[model samples]
Structure formats: C-alpha cells, structure tokens
Target chain A: MATARAADEAPAPAAPAFDVKNAFRNICGFCHEDYGRKQGKGPQLMDNPNSDDYLFNRIRNGKPGRMAAFGGAFTDDQIREIVVFIRKLKPNENP
Target chain B: MKRHSRKAITTASVAVLAGLAFGAQANEGILKRSANDWPSYHGDYKSWHYSDLNQINAGNVGKLTEAWSHVASRATRGLQGFPLAVDGVLYYSSPYNQVYALDGATGQMLWTYKQKLNEDLVAKQTHSPYNRGIAVGFGNVYMGTLDGKLVAIDAKTGKLNWETKLVNSEKLTVGFTGAPLLVKDKIIIGSQGGEWPWRGPIFGVDAKSGKEAWKFFVVGGNEGTASDRRDTWGGDSWKTGGGGGWMPGSYDADTDTVWWGTGNPAPLYDWAGDEWMTKGPRPGINLYTSSVILLNPDTGELKGYHQVLPHDAWDYDPASGELMLIEQGGKKYVVHPTKAGFVFVFDRTGKPVNVYKGVDNINFVQDIKPDGTLVGRRDMKEGKHGNLCPAIAGGYSWNSGAYSPKTGLLYKVGFEWCMDLEVVKTTPILEPMAQLNIGANFTFQPPKDGPARGHIRARDPVSGKVKWEMKFKVPPHGGLMATGGNLLFIPEADGWFSAVDAATGKVLWRHNNGQGHNGGTITYMAKGKQYVATVTGFGSLVGDAYGELWGEPWVSMPKDAGVLKVFALK
Candidate 1:
C-alpha cells in the first residue's frame, strides 16, 4: 500500500538524454551506417522520401521477413525521438 | 590437456548418431566419391578448396570469359559465400538468407528458397546475415539462419522441411553466420556472437526432428567435467566469455572428428585500468577462446583442444581460420592460420608440432612458451600500443586458405597492415545490444617502415615459410581455390578476379569485373567443360576497420552490387 502510494505520488521518470549521435553510432549505424547516409542491410534512412507515419510504422512494426520489430522494445516516445533524430540526418558524400 | 574417451556404443545409440538406416546414399556418394561435385561448403570435407579439374589450365586461362552472371534480388551487402554445385543445380545463398538453385550449365534459376528473418531476429545477428552457403544432404539443403534457426529445405522443391532454433536469441545476442555441415544425419552449426559476450558451443541438431543431438560448449560450464572451467574466469566473467565458433568446422571422416576453430575472448581487450597487476576483466589463459577444438561428431564430445594464443589481448580469433588437413612427411597435421599472423601446425591428437609467422614483422607476440602459449607484448594492456601488425583481422580472417596436394603449398590471402590499439575502462560482459563491448578499439595506421598493403602467399603448410608471394594494393577478401592445372584463383577487394601460377606467384590472367570479390570460389565440371564460380561485391567490416591512411579501396565499396560470376574457357 505504501509503495503504491509512493508510485502515485512521485514524479514521472524524465525522458533520457537521448544522444542521437551515440545512439546511431551504437545501433542503427551498424547497418544503415554513416549516420544513415549509406545503405547496408537496410536502405538509407536519411533524406528518405517516406512520411513520418511510414518511418515510424516501419521502425516499430518492421517489414515482414526483412527488418525486425522495435515496437515492443522501444517506448512510443523513444521511437518518436529516434524518428525525429533520423529526420534531421543530412546526406553526405562520404558515409 | 584432458581427453574424452570414445563413447561406449550400443546398437540404438550408434544408429541414432550415425544414421546408418536413413542414409541418403545419393548425397553421401556425391560427398565421398565425386570430385566434380562441390557438395560441401569447403568443397569437400577435407577443406582443401582444391579442385582436381584441369580442363582450364594456366596455359589456356587467358581465354577464360564470363560464362554467365546472376544478380541476387536483394543483395544489399557484400556476398561472402560460394555456390554448392550438386547434381546439375548450383545452390548459392545471398547475404539475406535467400538460397537460389541455378542450372549448373546455364545461369537460369531452378528454384529460389527465401527464408524471411524478421527485424528482431536480424537485430540479434552478431555478424552480417551473409551465409557462407548451404549444406546439402539427405535430399535437403540445410542452412543456419541469422535468427538462430537450423533450417532444412527440400533441395528440389525448395519447401521448408524443418526449422529448429539452435540458440535462444532473445536471451543471448548470438546467431549463426557459418553454414551448417550435414554430417551423417545431424546438421551441425556453430555460434557467431562472441563479441556480444557469448559463451561458445558447437551444436549438433538431429537431421530428422530438428532436436539438438548434442552440444559441446567451447568454454566448459557447471556440469560433470566442465566444473573445472569456472576458475578460469575472473569473478563471473566466465559466464559470458566470448569464444564463438563462427566459421564452419571440417569433418574428418577418417577419425570421426569434427575440427572447429574458436573466436576471441569477450571484450577484445581484456585488461582494464592498472588491473593487469591485480584483477583483470578476464584473467588466466582464457581456455578454448582462441583455439582449434576437436570434437567427436557423433556425440559432440570433446576430443582435445589446442589454444593458439593464450590470454589473447589482441582480437586474434582462431575461429575465422579454416581447419586444414595437410599431410607432411607421411604424417597428417591439422594446420590453422590464425589472426596472430601465424600458421599453426598440430598433430591430429592436438599436439602443437610447429608454429611460425605467416606474415612479416609480427611483433605482437614477443615470445612463445615451450607449450605453444604466446607471451604477448606486456605494453598492450590498458594503454595505446602503437603499430600492432596483422591487426584484428590478423594475417588472415575468415577468408579461407586453400591447400593443394599437387603443389604441396597453402595459398593464403593476408593483410600486411598494422593497427594502433587503444584500451579504455569498460564493462566486463558485452552488454546485451551494445555495438562493441570490448575494452579496446583499433584503427589502422601504417608502420613507420612502409604503406599498408595486402599479399597472397603460397606457403608451405608445415614450415609456414612463404614459397612465393604476390602483393596487392588492398587486402584480398575471398578464399583461394587451387586447381590441378598449376593455377591459383583468388578474388580481390579491388574488383579483379585474377589467376596466378601456382608454382610461382605470378599473375597469369586477370579480369576486371567492376566489383570486389569477398567470398569463397568454387570450381566444378558442368557438362563436359570446367567452370569457375565466385561472388563479387565487398563490404566486410574489415574494410571499415582501417582509416584514411590505407586507401579508399580498403573501406569504400559500393553497396548492393553482390553478383555471382561464372567463367570458363571461351
């Protein structure tokens, strides 16, 4: 009962300081490497012509037989954060 | 130094392991009797990569032309495997786990087997999903998937027979990159995520039910004989000591032994902050991490093991080397080319017979103990060690070396660059989904003496002495294929598929295919003529490992250009 009260009373956990650069370098960069400038296992995620909804759905649900689903692993907010980060990725000649 | 006695046999148990009753005679005969059939991944069980076909000789190789070409539908990454030609169809796998059966004579597709791996499965893969190739036996083509499934499909119909999850990818970040070896009735596959803190094992899945037949962990665990292995890890580091067997194992039908090489310890650099004097992330000679492990293919029982580099600080993974069976002076030896720049020769019983530097200026290993354990450079711990030659890819990596009985030489493609090692304080176990969990990182910087280069050497397997060597601008990426016609065929990173004289390492013929070759090459007889097949398009992480000091060819490769090229006498 006390723990429940504390949970109800405490402030919500703050969103993480999502280091987009480090996050890309660590995760998506392994395949859609060079800040998503070049294609790898997946197509280039930057300067993509797809909509936000398409990118978000694809990132979350993942295409069958091709990409993996990250919806279960990442929170909705986290996915949004990643999508926003990806949207800002600029295209460079050298990946 | 321990030995496992042979299993006491019973009629039922023998049948289960050997599959005497359910023997696929046709596939067995192709592997055992035929020289023209590229049945197994290493061509045959011998892992020689040598073809006895001499229809296209060095004298006439200049007339060789592209017989045909096939482009994979979704080959976005580098192609890293050869096609397995059996009967009249050539079976090849793309990096996306799609297997295609093409007409051996013509480049027409017979059937395509595409195994869909979801993002969750693909995320857990330790390396690129580029399967080396599929193994064929029992009328089925067996492949280990990036999602940790041992998938068997009907070789003719391309229908899925059975799919077995070999590793718990959800629990451990490990998957299969090696091709499954169809031995007897068992589909044997090994793990590939040692970098993700995987405790290694070679799994034998029952060919019929897809059930695990037996499992032999490279690093022993808390079981009967494995209890002794606990002391080797500092603290609980043994729980996730990386020693994955990423490459396929060689089957010795003669001794019933399957020889496999194991990868590096978890965290490429094991020491942390002055802990070299006290407690390290991983201490003691990390047993079985960088070694050639011999096992009884029937029971998955350990026969013996010989560690190539003990307490490996450098990422000198023995797992990438192909286990070679070379006979010297009437005695047989299991030769291994390691990332530590040495080709190690050992007797069949796991006794180290000889070890010599396969490349030039290997100063990482300062001394070698009497028992073959290396005394590496002490300064390599917890700090920047300048100019470590044969860097992480070693003298060679997963690109297999070929041995020819006719020439009595081993043809190896090796890198001649050195890298600077930088170790920083890091967590012990590789975090579940981290990019690199090691204590150190490396960047390619040329030695003070010369520029970074690659070499293809024809060396004596036993003596480790180079007979004749040819240099390349960048490291050659594919496996070597030696033919009986005094010609050596190898694929290069610079988009050239060239042939050199086997006796003298002279470039005899060359073809510019406009894409680099980073996979294995195979030769087989189709109809009455002989043909050579190899996949092109480079983009191995080894290419990404170097810096600008090397060259653009070393790092910059165009994506989605993976194509299989076939050549024969025009």
Candidate 2:
C-alpha cells in the first residue's frame, strides 16, 4: 500500500468559454451588421437558421466573388465555436 | 410629275449623306480614335473620358433607353472596367480573368475567353480579381490577370496569343486590377501589391512579342540598381517598402514620358506607432511612393517625380486619380485630384504650382509648399487615435474624373467621410498567403456632425475653384463621361446612373435600374447611333470594406444580374 501512494495532479483546465461577442465586435461585425440586426456587406444572420453543414461549408470554402473563406484563418474548433455563437444569436440583440 | 421627281432625288441624296457619315464614325472605332470610340481607358490618350458624339445630347438624353443587355455567366462581381469598342465588337474583362467580346449594337455574345485561374490561387490575392479592362493593340486584346499574368488574345478569334508572367506571386503577392496602357509599340502595365510586403514595379512589354522590354521599380533601393535611395530609408526598410503602380498611367507624347501616381509607403505607421514600441524604419520622406513619377515610356528611366504626400500614413494614393494636361494662362500644367482631397496643379517639370482643398473636410495637411510638398500634422507621428478627415478612402478615389476640353472644367465624384487613426504594437495580421501586411489598423469613422454624403463637383482647373456641386444621399462610385452635348454621365452606388448638366451640375436625367453602378462609363457609335454603356452590380473592395459607414440599404438592395446596360436615345 505504501508503494502505491496516490500522486496529486491538477485536472486539465476547462477550456475557456469562446468569446463570441468579442469576436463579433472585432472581426465579423466589421463586415456584417453588429449583432445581426441589419445587413452589412454580408447578409443578416439573425432569425435565420442554417444547417451545420451549410454553415461549415460556407464558412470554410466561402462563396467565391462574394465572401472571404475563414477556414484557413480559423481552426476547425475555433470555427465550430464561432458557428455555435452564431446559432445563439437572437434577433434584435444589441451585441 | 415634276414634284414626284424632286422628292425622289432629294431622298436619294439624303440617304447617301447618311451612309457617308456612318462610314466615318465606323472608321474612328476601328482606328482606336477617341472622339467616336472608347478605344482605351479614360476614353483616349488625354484621359478625358469625353466624346464628341452629340446625338445623345441634353435635349435628347431623357429619351435614352436600354437597347439590350447580356448577362455574363461568370466573373459576375461589380464590373469596374471600361469595355473596349472596336470595329462594331465590344471587348471587356471580368473578375476571375474572364474576357468577353460582345456585339456592340445588339449586346450579343460574340466570344468568351475564360482563363482557368485557380480559385485557391485567386483567393490568395490581396484584392479582388477584377480586371479594369482589356488593351487592344497589334490586332490582339491585352489584359493583366489577378494571378500576375499578362495575356494577349486574338481580337477576332479569341485565341490565346501569348501569356507572360509579369510578377511572381510567390515571391511577392501582387495582382493586376487596372487596364493596361498601350503606349506606342509597348504595352505598359502597372502591378497592384501596395498593401503587401512588396517592391512594386511598372513593366513595359513588347506589344508584338510579349517580351519584357523594361521594368521600373516603384520602390527605390533595389540591390545592384541605380534607383537606390538608401539614405531616405532607415535600416533595410527599402526591402519591403510599399509603393505599387496599381492604376493605369497617363503618357505625355510632348515629353515622351509616362506619368504614373505611386501608392502609399509600407508599414502605414512607419513614422508613427509608438505603442508597438517601434519607430518608423523609413524615417525620411519616402521617395516615389505617394507621388507622381515621370519616366521614359520606352526605357522606363526615371525623369522626375513630385511627392504629393511626404511621410503619409493615411494610405493616401495619388495615382488613383486621373492626370489631366491642361493649359492655364497659356502655360501647361498637370492637374491631379489627390487622395488628400486637394486638386494639385504641377508644371510639366514636376513642380507643384497650386493646391486647392477640393473637399471641405480635409484637415490632415495645413499647407502645401509651392513645389507640391505636403506639410504634415504634428499629432500624426505621436501614435494616438486622432480624428482625420477624408478617411482612408479620401475625398476622391480611383473612379477617375473627366476633363472637358470644351468646358475647361474637371468633373469628379467626391466622398465626404473621415476615419480614426492610431498606432498599436502587436503581430501584424496577414491575409491569406501573406498577401496583405498592413502594419496597423484603422476604422472608417463617420464625421461627428452629419451623415456621410457625396458630391458631383465641377471644378475649374485653372483657378481651382468649384463652379458648382450636386450633393447626393449616397456616395458616387463610378467615373464621369462628358459628351459634346454638355452632359456629364455618372453612376451612384445606390443603383442610379444619372446624366448631369456638365456646366451647372444639374440632374438632367436619372434611371433607377436597381443595381449598384460602379463601373467606368464609356460611349461609342454604331451605324450613326450614339450609345452610352456601363456595367451595374454591387461588389467593390472599397465599397464593401467601408460598408459599415457607407453601405446600409445599399448592401440590402437587390443587386442587378451584372448586366451590360447600353442606353440609346429613342
């Protein structure tokens, strides 16, 4: 029993919550409407539900001649996190 | 019997005269002349964008109607190029390196040349792959691509004659967005990579063979080259100094020199940006960039240059505007509407004579020296967010203005917006492929006083006085096309192409065709009928980049199907 003394270890820190508001204010909101209340260069994203597949492809591959693809800029996890934040966006929400 | 004979003979004579007139106008188009055909960008060597065709005059412009429209299948972004008209066939270039030759009279698709550009490669470009237009010379159509290739296709067959790689995209990310200027036997093309970590260049190629003739480096201090002005730059800053030749240059046959406006210097905050705990590397006035450079058209030799913005950080590009050669007080002067919102008049020897504040909100420079040297603000170098007028888009943009030899006035569209400026220390954000390395960031801020607006200004080139200005709700995006009938044709970003009174700035006629009209206006005649044509759509790097401030209902408006709108008087 003495040979099997338990060693104290710190559990992996929980991943920091994604700052969708900060990301929206700094990057996405520059081109799209802030909080998705109005249309900017890109279409309004509020009150609209897009499939995960459609959102993933559009964000990764981008619609040529219209939008810039973020697949290369953002990682798979980061993009997924962004999509999650986008899904939680409510119409008329003042971000 | 006598009356019938007289009527028949008179009718025969009138028909014969009409046939002769048609032949003359047709020849003008075939020969690439300016008066009757828009053979080149800016309409002619004078860069006037004016036509002597009076058929669609002020009295008859109200009757102008859409004759026909051809919807292009690809490269359907905003059409920014001036379609070249020659021998009844109209040729134009679109985004993604697509070329189309359409029937000038019927809008029928004659032939289309679609370049197999790698979308992955094009996505790496710093700017949109929109080609301003094609150059017609040596019986071939010439165009520069976003992938950095100079292509020549047979005008009649649309066959690829030759394709030459002008700039290596891997070494330095660059693209061609302006039309190539066919000067004499040489096809002069300007490269667009100002926003990248690049050493810009202006290349002269043999028109017939597509062989490189000469190259003029826009940024100075290249190793083993005489253009080294190392003293002007601190450390090795000259290696990546940004001074691109983005827009098509104007040539002066009188001086046998090519006059091109150079873009802003690299590290937009080189002189500022203390928070990054960094000082500007290129400390002295960065030569060549943000200036009007004069060079030998054949050999690419630097003759002279005049810096319009010394130590500039607001991304003010002087070369995006038209360079007008005018005679004031029996002397010749080059009138350039600078991005700083000033109409700068320089003598033929590259000496600044006068600077006039064309817009009301330009507060960056308090004064301009007699030789066109700029006086910078004291706070600009302090690295603090300060309110700067005319924004980064400035009072005017590359939507080149027109100078009417008839009116002695220059008609240009102006923006009345400003931006915020400051310096930050952090890793530079690089776009895909490191195509853009802008060392700092700024935001387009609307003026605190009022909503942003645009103006259609008629300025006298001699006195630098505004004769009249027509304000609008939306900022205009296209250039001006003046006709001999005292009409100035311009398009708005809000989807209306209107014809204004060239003399008084009166809105004579406007049509809401439901498309953001940002393409260059061009006019040509076929069979004695005058037609004014421009492309309409809603995608522009400038328009979209500043969408938060200038776009609203504009971005929400239903866009047109990228139609080649050709109007003719009924």
Candidate 3:
C-alpha cells in the first residue's frame, strides 16, 4: 500500500462559508427532491415533524442502509445550516 | 534473499502448470459457455445472457416448480448479483461481499464466505453493501469488494486465496459494485463512479497471484495515452472527471479485444448550455467517458474507442448497458444501450454503425445521427428546465438485457419517464472523502405521452426495428435471460418472476418471489437437469424512487432482504 500523501497530511485551507442551498442542490437533492420541498427517494424536509437535534444527528450520522452520512463532507455548523434551510423550506409559488 | 528467490522459483513453476490446465478450461468455459454452466457475468463473452439447455421448453415451462430457495444474509439493497453455475455447484454473491456456494439442484448450502469490510466507509456511501456478481475461474471465485479490494476465494472451500486492493475507496468513497470479468489470466474489474469527483479506473489484475498488473483511467487517458486524446478535457478538469466502466463488458475473442462502456462525467448536469465546448465544470468532449472503449486484455492497452455522447451533460451512461456482440451478414457489431434512451451500434473498430432511440421520451437531443453526432442539443442553463426526458434513473438502468441467437432479436427493457430539473453550480468536493456532485435538484414526472412506466421489447439490435413489446406500469429493474427453449425469463420489479414465450411475448409461467427483482437471472443445467435461477430483491438507487412514484408494494418492500429462487421441471 502507498503511504499517505503530504497533501493529505497538510492542514486544509480555510473554506468559504457553507452555502446550504447550493450544497443541498448538489448533494442532498439527489434523494430529497424539489430542494426538500417535496418527497422523492427520501422524506420531505418541508414542514418536517422531526426536532432540530434529530435532523442534525441524522444529517451528520445518517441512517444505515437508508441514507448516506454527510458528516465527513459537512461540518457541524454546515449541517445546522442545512437544518435551518429545511425549516425555512416552502413551496416555490412561482415555479 | 537467495533462499526466498529459490522458493519463489518453485512457486512460479507450480503456478504455471496449474495456470496452463486452468487457462484452457477457463477459455473454453467462458468463450463457448457450456450448456451446464453460466460461467461469466454476461453468460458468455458474447453477452448473450442465453443458455442452450432446452429441457424446460415453453410447452413444459408450465410444469416448472420451485426446486429450492436460499435466503441470503444482510441483503442490504436486495440480492443484486448474478448467480454463476459450474458443474453441479452454484456460486453467487450478496450484499457486503458475501459469497455463497450452493448445490444448484437442491439449493443446499455448501459454504459461505464474507469479506471483512470498512463499515464506516460503507455507511457514508450512497451506493454501498451490495455486490453485483462474481467470476469463477482457475479454481477460485473472484469478486470486487465495496472497500476497494479484489478478492479471490477458493471455489470449493470458500476460503480466501488472495485479496488485492485496487482503489482508494476510503478516500474516493466508491468501490466495485459490479462483478469482475475473468479474461484469460487476468481479472478485469472497474470501479464505481459517475457523480464522484475522481478519475474512474478499470484495473487489470493477475488472476493467479492477485497482483494488479495495470490500470486504465476511463475519465482521462493515462500517461501512455496520446497527448491529443488527453487534451480532450480542458485544463485540470480531467483531474476530477468522474467516469467508470462500472459494469462488466463483453469480449470479442475473434478480435482479441475487451469492450467496456464508461460512465458519465462528474457534476452530472452541466449548466454551461451551448458554451459547453469551452466552458462549464468540465469542458471539451471528456474523452473516454460516456463511450465504448476497446482494450487489449493482456496489456490493458486502449485499442479503439467511440465516444457515444460527446460532452455528456445529461448523466446518460453507456456503462449501464451490456456490450452485446452480434454478427449480421458477415459484419460483426456491438449493440450498446445508453442510459439516455438511445441504443448505439458500433462496428469492431469502434466506429458508429447506427444510432437509434430505445425509449420514446428522449428530448435531450433532437436526434443522435447514425454517425453519432448530436443535433439540436438541449443543454440546460443554471435554472429550472422542464420535461427532461428519462429521469435520473435512466431509460436503461444497470441491469442487462438478453440477446438470443435463436430469435435473432434483442430482448431489452426501456423506461419511460422524465424529470423537472433545477441545475445549480457548486464546487467539486474532493478533499475529505469524495461526495456526490450531482449539480441538480429534480423531481420525477411522467413523460409527455404517458405515465412513468417501462416495457420489454424484442427488436432487431442492429436495425432498431421492434418486433413485439410488452408494457409494464413500472419498469422491471432486473437482468433478463433468454434460452434455447424459446423462453425469456423476466424478473419483475413488482416481485413477480415470469417466463414468457420468446417467439411471441406471452407469459407462460409466473411465480412471486415476494420482492422486487433488480439483479440477474440465468438458466443452467445442474445434475443433468435444466434449472432457472434468479436473485430476488429490490431497493436499488433506481428502484428507490418507486416508493414515491408508485404506491403499495414498493412502499412496503423491504430493502434489506433477498432470496435466490431456483426452479425446474417438477
């Protein structure tokens, strides 16, 4: 096996503030359809009955076999932003 | 060091003799495909998915009854692997790299082997756990694992002989869900890719020693690749251009070439519109991705290639379909179905012979000419676009169709669906473990002509003329099998396994396996008796949409369950 690359060991550069809408469209929207306003492969995030803590944990550590864990891809703050985005989701009246 | 060299020489001598004996059998078994064995993933190198065993014909197919059943453990996304039979023993794989050897006639479990996997990585993956199939050759069963390793187990003892890590799955977040194709002395396997932002690679490994011999990247050509070919991807976009030969393609022994179809580039939906040639997440045609490539099995060298969809922005992968080798009027042709609802016919030299629509819902392009040029491109911008024909699930998903030499027709499935998309521009994530770079949010919808549905069509593969078709409310997401008995075995997405008369699309026998079918089916002779075997289960990425698109059975179907159902004349 090859040794770990120096790039991997080096400290990660500071990233821009997470954009929940774009991120959701890129990743989460694969299963959660309509920007989470309607259900598709996953449950609709709009008007969700789950609590903040539930959403946060689920996003970080996903349900096995049901959803992929995004914790490695997203920070805690980013996941919280996603939870907030879910809370604010509403039907696109114009769309 | 001197003593070690002496021992290595001794081992090499023994391996060569064993290889000589095994290579002869493997070549004959795979190239000709004995009536008693379903040796390769495509049944044979022709990718016919057909068996010549005719004990159970259409006249007596009604007398067929369940011989036995084996429920596989940890069938996470249902049993999605094709079962291979050799002699009287049956070998198959399930989720989590679980391999099982069974008595093909009795379903008696002989032994089971499960690979130790990196559970954490599997949990973070969108496509995980399930193993599509296994290849048996040289007295070992070879399977590619979810944790980026190709493992070979003793076909008899079910013990590990060797395990070689081929990919950095912990970092790339994708591994092998497809089966490895055993060609000659090498095990050829491709990694899972498409949305992940990394160069998808297909590896050629030494079958005897489990050592990686060579690797070829499908996204961008390797160092040995021509400079002009490597320049197909603009700038550094090729560095993370997602493409993979995710499925097991067939071989043309006459030409001594292995044909493989590659996945689409990453960030599936490009928002560059018509400026895609010089702008977007990845500019240029993205060379080998979304194309049919021919490789030399011995050297892993690119022999020839045809880019089916140049600058494939719609995520329509040719990788999902089977590379069927057919001959007509002394001309050899390769019939490949692209996920974008079109079937591309290519000659032995990788030149387009013809291009035709497999599904009616396509509007991604006004037409793909016989010369393989895109006309009237509907490149979407960074906004909402309606009626994107053939939803993300694709017109043709990963499951394969069967071609019958007897009927001279191809039996395949075509999905009818569309989607409304909202393309978003996002940065490619590659550092802390790769993530899906879909670049779009879409909802599944019915096509303009009808409700979202599927159908089975018997057509002239080269000419694209439909002889007959059978429609379904929802597409069956399983591999098809045709037999010399003049029967077509279809594993339905709604839990019904039916045998239809190949001559006339009439259902002769039906059995409910109690779950949706999304894997493979084949017919083989075990203990001098003809038997049909199919893996039953559902919950594939494509089938996952069924719960929301349709109600009832799909919503209630268990995603983590599967059964290997076998049948024979009672």
Ranking by TM-score: 3, 2, 1
**DockQ per candidate, 2 decimals:** 0.06, 0.06, 0.30
lDDT, candidate 1, equals: 0.70
Instruction: Give stretches of model 3 more than 4 Å off.
Output: A1-15, A93-95, B1-25
Pick by TM-score: which candidate is best?
3
Docking class of 2: incorrect
Per-residue lDDT value at B549 in model 1: 42
List candidate 2 stretches off by more than 4 Å. Answer: A1-60, A70-95, B1-34, B221-225, B271-278, B376-384, B426-432, B545-547, B550-552, B558-561
Interface RMSD of 2: 15.5
A1-95, model 1: which lDDT tens digit per residue? Answer: 00011111222222245544434443454445445664544567878999998988887776433454656545677778888988887754322
Candidate 1 DockQ vs. native:
0.06
Model 3, span B230-349: residue lDDT tens: 466766677778998889988899889999999899889888887777677777788788988899999889998888888888999888899999998899999888898899999988
Residue by residue across B1-570, what tens digits does model 1's lDDT show? 111132212234323323211234433643573666788888777788988889988899999999998988666557888788865568898876898888878988878998867656565343665777778766667888776778877666676767777777655655777887777767788887556655777898776566788877666432476324545555556666777788887877778888888878766675443243225666556677777888777788777888776666777888888778777889998888877777778888888888877777577777655357666554465656677776666778788889888889998887777766556545532333433345553555565567777788888898877788888767777888999888899887778889988999888899987877778898887787788999987666564443244445544566566888999898
Worst lDDT window (10 residues) for model 2 chain A? A1-10
Instruction: Choose the strongest candidate by DockQ.
Output: 3
Q: Is candidate 2 or candidate 3 better by lDDT?
A: 3
Candidate 1 retains true contacts at a fraction of 0.03
> Given candidate 3, what's the lDDT at residue A31?
92
